[model samples]
Structures are given as structure tokens and as C-alpha cells.
Target: MLLVDFVLLSIIVGLLRKGSLKKIGEIPIRKLELIFLSLIIRYLPLFLKGSLKEYVVQYILVVSFISYGLLLYSLLSNWHLKPLRIVTLGVLLNFLAIIANGGKMPVSLLAVDFAGLGDFKQDLFNPLYPYHVAMMPKTRFKIFGDIFPLPKPYPNPKVFSLGDVLMGIGVFSLIQEAMLKKKSASDKISRRKLKRNL
Candidate 1:
């Protein structure tokens, strides 16, 4: 995931350096600001501490999803393409999985217990409450269980699926692209000013 993010960032920066998005640079940064804010808010659940944190995180999740959806809608209104579609699908899948699993991806409690997660009430067990009931898609229509993760040697490797990987890549790609475009526009503006002065 990190490697993919780095590669996407590099590509975006390279494109920006080429001044491909110079014209679009003049547009207001409000849209970009929303995206950046959303990114920060989306991850707040993982770091929040204390009893009230869960409620706070849940509220933030709802708001963040709505804001993100709106932001995507606004961005796609002016831009459309195959790459965007692929990224959108990945994001939607990830969101659905999260929502289906109680706003957080469920990990195997047994797996965690075996890994020596001493206290089950800690932040690590935030995914699922009890041993049997997991915030995950179960076999039955109404049941939900942490039926994810393939059989691996590690007891508690972060059990993320293929959808998550794709989503992460898409997110990284989008951010890198935006930053590169902004930087490129700034450089082009500077060059134009220099030419005018000369």
C-alpha cells in the first residue's frame, strides 16, 4: 500500500511538473480543502481515546462519509473517465464493507486473543464486541460475523481484503494527483510572471 501510494504520488508530481493542469489550478481550493479535511476525519476513529471516543468516532464517520460523497460528486461533475470509475468502485466497496461491519472492519477476536491481546476491551477489540458476534457479513441473511481473512501464519495480521487494498491505492493516487496538479500550476504561474517581467 505504501509503495503504491508513493508511485501514484510520483506520477502525479511528474504530471504537475509538466504543467498539464495549469488552467484548472486557478479554480478555488475549497473542493480540495474538503477532501483534505475528510481524509483527516476519516482516520480519527483509530487514534481517539477514552469512553466518549466511540460515539465521537461514529458521528465523525457519518459526517465524513456524507461530506466525502458530496466531494466526489462535485469533482466528478466536471471530470469523468475510466480511471476515475475504477477508483470510485473501489472506494464504494470499501465504504460498504465498513458500513456493513458497524463502521469498522471486524477482526477475529480469537485470533487477537491468541496473539496475546491481553485485554479484549482495548481499542483493538473495537471491531467486534463478543467472541461469536462480529461486525461482519455472515453466512445467514441476518447474521454477521468476522468471516474475513485467509488462513495465514500470523495470528493477527491486519485482516484487510483485496477491496481495501484497491481502495487505499485509489485514495493515495487521488491525493497525489491533486497535490501534483496544484504544485505544477504554482510553478507555471511563477514562470509566466517571470516572462512578463523580463
Candidate 2:
């Protein structure tokens, strides 16, 4: 939800800067389907919790790693884009944290309480949850976990990780670049026409 907010904000900012919406389509993002496939693989286990729940749980880590690999590969395919490089770095940070913690993201209990989601504590601790685990003394790479709290009065408060922040910034920058680049090109053409008329 917070990420969605970031995207909306980016679009709003771009429009305010006199950027054209059509310019976003000009971005040379390659292999976009891999990102969707990665997401599908990551969440597929969540919906298969009836007949193959046990099997899914047992192999969830493998599934996660594979999904991350696909996502990374797709992101790397657009490595020439500076904003995407930052986004890829953020994803790499998350990948390292998950791998270090035995395939589950560690969530800080304190952060959950701060975010007014205390009710979710039990789910965080549940072994079958398959996505997040409660942060503890034994949790590895604690710095990379979801420890930052975004408390209420905000629209969609939630606990987020450092990597999430980086990704948001990267996305915002990407949109800005697309918007401004288009505007600058148009301005140059207009100036050339004015010089010709003069």
C-alpha cells in the first residue's frame, strides 16, 4: 500500500512538473513479464494451502529464492537505467536478508505495535505463515528487516524495510526522469522553431 502511494505521488509530481503521461511508455524497460512471473511464483504458495499446503511450506524457501532470482534477472536486463540500478540494489538487500534468515522476512514486534497492527503478532510468529517471522535475538541481518514504523494519522500506516525506502526513491526518480526528459526535448524543439521564425 505504501509503495502504491509512492507511485501515485510520483505521477502527481510528474504531472505538476508539466510532464506528459505518454512519456512513461517510452521507458525502455525490458522483460517486464519476468517481474509478474516472479510475483506469481512468490505468492502462489499462499493460495495453495489446502491439499498441498505441507509440500508448499516445505519448499517455500526454494520458491522464494527462485522468484528473487527471476526478479533480479529481469531488473538487471535494464541495468543501463540508473534508477533501476538503485531498485535492483534494494531488491538485493531484501534477498540477502531473506536468505540470511532462512527464507522468511523478520518483522520487528515493536514496529508492528507502533504501526497499530498489534493484532498481527500471532500471525507473525506462526511457523506456517511462510512470509514473515517475528524478529528475535537469533534473527540474522536484523538491520535489513521490517523495523521501520509508520504510525497512524497517515493514510496507510505499516512497517517497512530500508530496502522498501530505496525502491520508492528509485521509482520516484525514474518517473521524474521520464517526465522531465520529455518536457526538455519539447522545449528544445520549440526554441529551435522560434529561432527559425526570427
Candidate 3:
């Protein structure tokens, strides 16, 4: 998903500016473990036997929704940060769509074709292996689902949700601020040391 790519790119940008990886610090979530646990909950079922009936599959997705919700709440609790606030709104929008749709995210076929992901049933699943189904006539909050595309010629062509866009913005802003903050602190320390040496 673009969220993963967005986070990776944010860290890369910070490091490129000579900001130490440590400058990114811990994301200001109260229960950091919950975030990790959420990821595991969302992805652990992919390896399970596909022989699972439809309802069982849906239940697996329900567990994923709950886990992801906890993680989102942890992040939102720190919403005073501009980036976090933007990310929270985007996440809630996505959550609304997922929860309303049998716990599976809806991806528009048009978006998939636009991304050149092909019409293969297997390709229907997002590469993130998120429990997503094709968007139907009655999909709620369809705008929040994977309805946008990064088409061919893009390094990573993919269908993304509106939530993905806002999350990307938040991630970029968070890293930019952290890197600048670290630089300011370093400059202050250096000036102080220089004066003492003088």
C-alpha cells in the first residue's frame, strides 16, 4: 500500500538531508505495541488456508478491522500534531468505508485498470494483501476507497485511496519537521560549544 511506501520515503528524505534516523524518533502513540500488533492482525491471515469459507474469511477481516482501529485511535490521541490530525481524518474516512463494506476495502475496477494491475482475479487483491474486494454498485463512501491510480510510467503504479493521499502528506510533513527540528537543536549546541571554546 502507499502508506508503507509513504513512510519509507519519509524516512529516506530525512536521512538524505543528513538527519539521523533517530531524529524521526518514536511516533507519538501511547500504545506503540498496539500499532505493531495491528499490523500482525491485519496480515497474519493471508497465510491461512484459502479453504476458509466466505464467512470465516470475513471474520478474519473483522479481527483486522478491530486491530487497525486500536492503532488509529492511539495515533489520533496525539492529534495536536498537524500531520497526525490530517492522518486521523483520512483514516477515519477509510475506516468508515471498510466497516460499512463487510470489513473489506473496496477497490474500483476502473482504478485497477488505470494502474495496469490487470483484470486477473488474483490481481484483484491489493499487493499489501489487504482484505479488499471489488467495488460494487452500492459501495458506501466509494470516494474513500481505492479509486485513484498511479498509472504507467510511475515507478510504482498502483490504485490508492483518498486516505492514502492524506496519510502521505502527513508522513512527509512529520519527517520534514523532525529533520528541521533536529538541525536546529544541533546548531544551537554547536554555537554554545564554539562560544565556550572561544
Candidate 4:
């Protein structure tokens, strides 16, 4: 949901600048396949049945977190892009926090209540949702947990983390930068074609 907010904010900013949706498509995310691989690994538990689901889900969660770290590392390894680098660092922080807390992203009960999901239970293996669990007194890396609440002030009420804030900034910067670069490149091409025609 944090990522969804990033996308929506980026789109609004892009529109404000008269940028086209195609500009966002031009963001050069590196090792994109690794991101997909991580998702596939994360969701792989859905295919399991019976008691095997719990054990396999736990194992896959570890593997999925590892895959996520790899994806961030891969993205950082390429382009030397500042925005992507920031996002990679943010993702690394989130990965570390999640792995340290048994591969589940810690959710603050207070934030949950603020989000109008106060009735949220301690269900970690809900088939409808995955990889999220309530933050308890024993949850490690408490600062990295979902402590931020976007309440009624915003249309969408959600809980987010500090790393999520960092990543949101990075996502907006990446999209805005891509839009400028795309427009600049298009202008140069148009200029070249015009000169040739003349």
C-alpha cells in the first residue's frame, strides 16, 4: 500500500508537469527480473496444502527476503542513479528489519487502529494476505516497524514505516527525473529530424 501511494503521487506530479504516462515507463529499474523472482518466491506458498503450508511458508519467507535483498543490491549495482540507490538502501533497511523479526513485517497495532483496521487479529497466514503480522512487545527493530499512520487527513488510511517514507521519496524522485530525461531526449530527436528535413 505504501508503494501504491508512491505510484499515485508520482502520477499526480507527472500530470502537474504535463508529462505523459510513457515517461514513467522509461524508469530504468535494474535487474527487474530479480524483483519478479522475489515476488514469485514470496507467493509460492499459495500453491501448498495442509500442514505443509506453514513450514513451507516460513522457509519461503526467508528465501523471499533474501531474494528481495538481492534485487535491491542488483538495482544499486547498476546506473549509479541516486534515487534508485536511496530506494535500495530503504529496501535494505526493510529487509533487515523483516528478517530479524522472523521474516514478517511488523505492523503497529496503534497504526492499524488509526487505519480503521482496529479489528486486525494475530493471523499471519491469512490466505488473502501474506507476509504481515502484528507487532508485539518482543518484535525486534521496533523503530523500523509500521509506526507511521496516514489517517483521515488522507483519502487512504494506511500504516507505513520509516523505510517506506524513504522509498516513497525515492520513487517520486525517480519518476520525476525520468520524465525530464524522456522529454529532453524527445526534444533532441525532434530537433535532429527537423534539421535533417531543412
Candidate 5:
């Protein structure tokens, strides 16, 4: 997805700079984005569960929220705003979701029952557990929004949602926008220099 974003963004930038796609209003709408969003929405309901489901859904949502927030800020901001704002939002959302859903993101203690991770599932369920990476922040997060390969799972593993994919795409788009801006600025500078010399 990131690679695709870069390619699409590069082409768009080239067109805009060359005056082929002359106006911001002329930009094409992203239809395929709707399909992607639908797929993500399918996973959002997992948060209501107490079992491993809730932890997985919430984890995906938080990551997506962060990534999407970053993407939106980069695209909409004047390019002068600090990037940290987007990153901070992502982190805060993740923390809040972790707190709201459970002390950790409700990992399946049962699954880790056999992993010999010293009762990882029990620790994840425990309200008193510290904010260790194994508990809240790390385990339940997405692995590119796919199945997790648990290494002695201490917390829940392999969960994500529609929000995560959206966030990933948004992050991809923002990066594309940044590269486009740089190319635009460079083109403008070259044009100005040429005009001055002429």
C-alpha cells in the first residue's frame, strides 16, 4: 500500500507540476478507497467482547487512529506544522483504548496457557499489571493487519480492525503528499531561476 501511494502520488505531482491536471478540483476521487473502508468496518465490532476479541479490535482501532490522524494532519496542514502532533494523537488514543477496554487489550489468557510465557494470558487479564509492552501496548497491535505469530504470548495476539487499515492508508497518503510538496517547491524554484536569468 505504501509503495502504491508513492507511485500514485508521484504521478499526481508530476501532472500537477506540468499543468496537465490544472486544478485541485480536477483531482480524481478515490473509489477503491470505499472498498478498503468496508473491509476495515467489518472488524470494528470486536471491541464489545470480553474474550480475546475485544482486545484485538481495540488494538487495531488505536493503531489505525494514530496512523490516520498522521495522514490527515500532513495532508491538510500547511506543511509547516510539526509532525509530532499526529504521532501524539495516535499514542494518546492507543493508551486511552487500552485503559478503557481493560488494563491491557484483553488478550486470551487461554491461548497463552500452553506457550510457557509464564502465564502471559493471566497477566494480561490482571488489572494490576504494569503498562509493560507485553501487556497493553505491544501484543495486541497489528502485524500489518494480519495473523500474529505469537512468541510465548503474554497478552492477546492477532487482532486488528477497519480503523487500522484506514490509518495505514492515511499514513501512506500523507507521506505521498509530503513528497509531492517537496517536488512542487523544487519545480517552483527552478522556474523562478529560469525567469530571472531570461
Candidate 6:
């Protein structure tokens, strides 16, 4: 959800900067299918938990590692893009944190409470959750966990990590670059056409 907000904000900023949505299609992102596939696999357990809870939980760690690997591979394939490199760094941070924390993201209880989502504390601590674990004194990679809070007055209150913040910035920059590039190209074409007509 926070990511959605980041994208929306980026698009709005791009439009304000006289950038066109048409240029988004011009961004040369590779292995787009792998990105989608990784997300689907990462969240598959959540959807199947009703009936296949045990099965999903049993292999959740393997599935998570595989999904993260796929995502990292896809991002690495586009390393030529500066913004994507930043995004790759962000993903790497998250991957390390998850791997160190036993295949689950550690969530700060203080951040959750600060975000006014205390009700979800139990879920975060639940062994069956298969995604997040409550941050504890012994939690590894605690610095990379979801320690930041987005309090109310912001449409959606939630907790996020440093990696998430970096990813958002990278995404914003990517959109801005695409939008400006399109505008520059169009201007060049118009100037060429004008000179030919004169």
C-alpha cells in the first residue's frame, strides 16, 4: 500500500513537471514478467492459507528465498539504469534482513503502535503468519527491519523499513527521468521539423 502511494506521488510529480504518461512505456525495464511472478509467488501462501495453511507454512521459507532471488535477478539485469541500481540496493538490504531473520520480516512493535495499528500486533507475532515476526532483542539484522512508522493524517498509516524508503526514492527518480527524457526527445523532433519547414 505504501508503495502504491509512492508510485502515485511519482506520477503526479511527473505530470506537474510537464512529463507525459506515454513516456512511461518507453522506460526500458527488462524481465517485467519475472517481477510479477516473484510477487505472486511471495504472496501465494497468504491466499492459500485458508485450506493449505500447513503446506504453505512448511515451505514458506523456501518460497520466500526463491521469490527474492528472482526479483534480485530481474533487477540486476537492468543495472545499467541508475535509478534501478538504487532500487537493487534497496532490494538487497531487504533480502539480507529477511534471510538473517529466518525468512520473515521483523516488524517493530513500537513502530506498529506508533502507526496506530496496534491491533495487528498479534498477527505480527503469530507463527502461522509466514511473513512477518515481531521484532525482538535477539532479532538479527534489526537495523534493516520495519522500524519506521507512518502515523495518521497520512491517508494510510503503516510501518516501513529503510530499504522501502530507498526503493520509493529510486522509483520516483526513475519516473522523473523517463518523463523528462520524453519531453526532451519531443522537443528535438519539433525543432528538426521546424528547421526543415523553414
- Lowest-sum lDDT 10-residue window in model 6: 49-58
Give the lDDT of residue 26 in candidate 4.
65
Clashes of 1: 0
- The alpha-carbon deviation from the true structure for residue 190 of candidate 2, after best TM-score superposition, in angstroms, is 14
Number of colliding residue pairs in each model: 0, 0, 0, 0, 3, 0
lDDT of each: 0.49, 0.87, 0.76, 0.75, 0.42, 0.88
lDDT of 2 by residue, 67-150 (tens): 999999999999999999988988888888887887788999999999998877998878777788899999999999999999
Task: Give residue 48's error in model 6 in angstroms.
Answer: 0.5
Off by over 4 Å in 5: 1-96, 108-122, 126-128, 131-158, 180-182, 185-198
Better of 2 and 3 by TM-score: 2
**Any idea how many clashes model 3 has?**
0
- List the candidate numbers ranked by TM-score, top first: 6, 2, 4, 3, 1, 5
TM-score of each: 0.49, 0.88, 0.81, 0.83, 0.30, 0.90
Instruction: Identify the runs in model 3 with alpha carbons over 4 angstroms from their true place.
Output: 26-28, 50-56, 123-130, 183-198
lDDT of 3 by residue, 43-83 (tens): 66676655453345658557757876886977776776878
lDDT of 4 at 6: 92
The C-alpha stretches of model 4 lying farther than 4 A from their native spots are: 46-49, 122-130, 182-198
TM-score winner between candidates 1 and 6: 6
Model 3 residue pairs with clashes: none
**Residue-wise C-alpha lDDT for candidate 1, range 1-198, written one tens digit per residue:** 332543455466656577344433443434566666656666555566766665665455474466457656644643543345445565555555555544554455554454454454275444322112243236222212233333336433333444545555655555445545544688899999999999
The C-alpha RMSD in Å for every predicted model, in order, reads 7.4, 3.6, 4.0, 3.1, 14.1, 2.7
Please state the error at residue 166 of candidate 3 in Å: 0.8
For candidate 3, give the lDDT of residue 76. 72
Candidates ranked by lDDT: 6, 2, 3, 4, 1, 5
Best by TM-score: 6
